[model samples]
Target: MTNNTQSLNSDIAAMAEKEFEGVYGRYRITSTDELEVQRYRLALLLCGVAFTAGLGQWLMIGPTWAWLWLLPMSIGLGLALNWIHIYLRPLHQALKLLWALGCLGAVVMAWSVGTDTMLSTVTAEPAWIWAIGPLFAALTGVGFKEFFCFGRPEAIGLTLLIPIALLGHLSGLMSGSIVMGLLGSAALLLLVLALRKFGMDAAADVGDKSVFAYLSNPQANEAL
Candidate 1:
């Protein structure tokens, strides 16, 4: 009788476990997803390096050739945006489009003024902000999504500092020193956020994969 009771209990536990998995298995993190998350984090780290290099160049703290970092900065931002897992597909698509447009504008601006004077041209012409603004806008979107998901102080700082610095420069409302200070702060915040992400579990950055599935299948989701 004792042996029979033990077997019955074990069977019951197995059934319950199977049922729980059936319902929630979609939420499980797979190895491939985790690997992808690592790639995304690496892209973010690259972005941080580029931002730091650009800031140093802006402040004349680095070699004049450091401005060449802009190419890698654009590449890193594109990769990061592509790999970021957002539940809303449309928003994700929009961010990529913005990045592309910004790149196109940058190329046009560079062509118009020549690579040698690109930086000086932008400084002399406030209207060029419109050309580069989309790139920063997409970056701001990334910062906002990170803050919304993780509530990180650095993420929120990037979201706020970017627009402030750009608008300040565009409107000529803030002194050059003030704009420089804000941009420097933004670069530091981005580096901090990127480094901190590495210490976090990849699942946190990947978010709820089930929600992505639900959103992807509108008809099936509505049927439920």
Candidate 2:
């Protein structure tokens, strides 16, 4: 029984190793630390986009058609993020499609917001209704991806935007711009925290490797 169990375990381990190699065979990931850094960089870029967009709306920082810029900005960022991931590992087809849909949703949301603001007879309610739908849909895709791939905090941070938008519209606590700015600011804070955590984790990893090396070398232990 023990020999059979050992053979089964070896088979499973071999299959797992082969699968992992196949998945990353085409990509060159220098280290786990590099991958984590890339992920954090993507998060920071997204945080910047959210914060800038919120600030723009709050300050009324651009012309009525300014939202159109979001289409290109979102697509560019989505592509860049995906590019980074693809360089590190092979991506599922569904993941690629999700990113594409997110970019499309962003474009649609920007168009809807711009058009509604220009043409709506009743401004506040209709504008938010139309705007929130696409924004939430896009964010759902983002949150789902983040939850599965990046981290729970990022997913939760994005998911919170749904309620933030809904309550901001209904309660009239502040303008949409102010609410968005506040939420975006919160997301930015979360990103900062996540980055720091990942940095610390990487440092711990280095320390652990150093300790392992020292402990494994009998000569070094003897010198100590």
Candidate 3:
């Protein structure tokens, strides 16, 4: 009777251990995390498509039509910024803040001068770049982060191209043709970067979950 009781207790302990492992194992990805990653990837893809579509419309159709693409581009960017898992909480929050400011700036620009004329107004008054610059700045931050983590050439190119194009136009240093070329290149590079990310393991993008856990918990840091 005693032996049977001991065996039964051991079995129960083993079962409990397995259940715990299934739920909270170090390397295990919860369904929730997986779903979040999927959304992040989808947002990235949307951004790429929006960039390509906007550029194409600007070149082939009309600038007014291209401006419409900003809606989806902004949406995708905002979603990506929200869902992105950065180890440093402060940096992540800063990026989101920048995005918010950019959106606010865009709204002000649109309200001041109707949506159809916003692009032309900004082009005519380079000083207005200040109003819309934060959006691209946030985008540049994303590119820099991607390049730093993945060493992707397209990402680095995007990081550099955006500032150069915007500043060149803002300072009246580059011709319209030159600025257009630079922006077109940036759009292509962003599209390439986004598509390549889809082929990568989602786990790579999520990075080390332990770092996120350590950063989020003040008590854990205090214990350390």
Candidate 4:
């Protein structure tokens, strides 16, 4: 190693030694590790479902009047984001299970909405029901945060979906429910597969967790 790198390595090794020895290591600047983004994804899905559940209370309040409380949920969600700095990720098997469930739900929701509102939509139930596509997509995505992995497929899929989602929603205003349902289902299923395949996989080390052993120790991932 060069003089500078050797010096830095010496320093880090010394620090690790001290911590392992129970020395005055409290003040040491150890690596600040955060949980994987997948963990936050679980919270995100809960948040989406929770926020939507508020719609029940919104129901009691009736109509556009419920917009007043939107700020509270928005702010609460903002504060929650701060916790991204600290968390422990779950195992890969769990992510796969969640992925399977999300895909199944996407298929069911699409089929149901398509069948129910096929003839006539735009009224209270259909409008809300049709919202399920994005709601499912968002919540499913929230359960599995794969922003990086989703780049190419998701970008293209969403690019293909947006105009259609908007147009379908808007068309509920003029076209029969059958047309709206058909259009909505067609676009949304595309998003479903792309997201399921890419978003569900376990990603790289999520946040900035230090890997002293992985970096310095020779056999960290030797088995894998």
Candidate 5:
């Protein structure tokens, strides 16, 4: 009877140890997943800013309001860049280089459009074409960076925005602002869905920990 009891005790201890190891492994994986999810959330916020800006532009809002969009957009961009630097320290320089290039390209594109506007023969419609290159480059660059940090689904989704906007432009069904607004809206929708899933997953992790804590705590049962 004593031998049987000792063997049973050993078995239970081994089992508990194995379970703990599995849980620790899962915790590590979940932590990594949570970081990616947060990064995606930031991306979503940036998309929201873009959507607002595009909509505001479409409505021909005041320049002051248009400039205000830049503040949020800049904040989002800074957060994204900082997050990338923190999590991907090795590629920080490369990402910064890409961002600087994108910004420069956008500035040049804007300057070209302004110049076109000043020309007597240049039409407003044709001036928009100059902006397309910078837009595509920026979107593709962002998707590429995200591909490294997140996964293919997000990267593909972000990249698709460029082509979708381009198609809208080529189709002539809507103006550039409307096309941008539509793309931003679509991106925002995807971000919201992804964020909800991430949030639920994180909540589950917390719930699991709570259950584990309750099960392990002698005081918890006494209190209950």
Candidate 6:
């Protein structure tokens, strides 16, 4: 067995050498730069805005002021997301983990706070709301890997956040209260992905390439 293992190791090393012989550089599947870093951050920010905006308007502005604050907030979020996408067109990798985690964190917040205000016409089920966090985390993990090439921060943050968001959404949705679950759920997916991708990027661009200043009191700014 020992001899066989040694032989296998030698063969594997030889094969690896042969495979890399023609390659110019090490196959770094995780290499990234400034623009990508910002992109991840951007995704998180957008997720938070949409999540809060969607539920906040539904709950905060009574029938009389329903369209008032919500519409403006929606429009503002849209514009800000777009602006961030364009503004951080040249960033890189150090920020990759930051952005992914940030986005995940944002979605978690959205589910927690936003779901509480969903329409009561058909009351959403706790089971369904409970599922939102895991779903968001899983999908975002894929997106982070697909778009940014790294997802440790995303995976970690999402793991920690899923349960919290589940609790928040569950409290609001209740049982059969809102029939908009299907539609609302779908909307959350889009909101989470887009917001994470663009929101953090624009934010990271604040103050001449300084992520530190950009993140200072981030949650306060996000909820406001």
The TM-score leader among the candidates is 1
lDDT string for model 5 (1-224, tens) is: 99999999877655543122333233222444456547745764674556456445635643333434433544455455554323233455455555555456445644664432221111235444343334344445556665554455656666676566656666576685676565665456445433543444433322233344454567865875
The segments of candidate 5 whose C-alpha lies over 4 angstroms from its true place after superposition are: 1-40, 60-71, 81-98, 109-158, 167-181, 190-224
For residue 36, model 3's alpha carbon misses the true position, in angstroms, by: 1.5
For model 6 the local lDDT of residue 142 reads: 35
Cα lDDT tens digits for candidate 2, 130-197: 43344344434445454555466756666676556546665776675666565555456444533544
Question: Residue 17 error for model 5, in Å?
Answer: 18
For model 4, residues 1-224, the per-residue Cα lDDT tens digits are 59999999978766653222212223222333223344444444444334444444444554344333333433333333433322223423343344444345434644665533322332434444334334334323332343433454544444444345445555564444443354344334433433354354232323223443333344644643
TM-score of each: 0.85, 0.44, 0.84, 0.29, 0.45, 0.29
Full-model lDDT for every candidate: 0.82, 0.47, 0.81, 0.40, 0.49, 0.40
Model 6 residue 173 lDDT score? 39
What is the C-alpha local distance difference test score of candidate 1? 0.82
Mind sharing the TM-score for model 3?
Answer: 0.84
List residue ranges in candidate 6 displaced over 4 A.
1-32, 62-122, 130-133, 139-162, 165-224
Q: Which stretches of candidate 2 lie over 4 Å from their true place?
A: 1-47, 50-54, 60-69, 80-155, 166-178, 190-224
By TM-score, the candidates rank as 1, 3, 5, 2, 6, 4
Better of 1 and 6 by lDDT: 1
C-alpha-based local distance difference test score of model 2: 0.47
Looking at candidate 4, the ten consecutive residues that score lowest on lDDT are 18-27
Sequence-dependent TM-score of model 2: 0.44
Candidate 2 positional error at 20, Å: 10
| Residue 147 in candidate 2, Cα distance off native in Å | 5.6
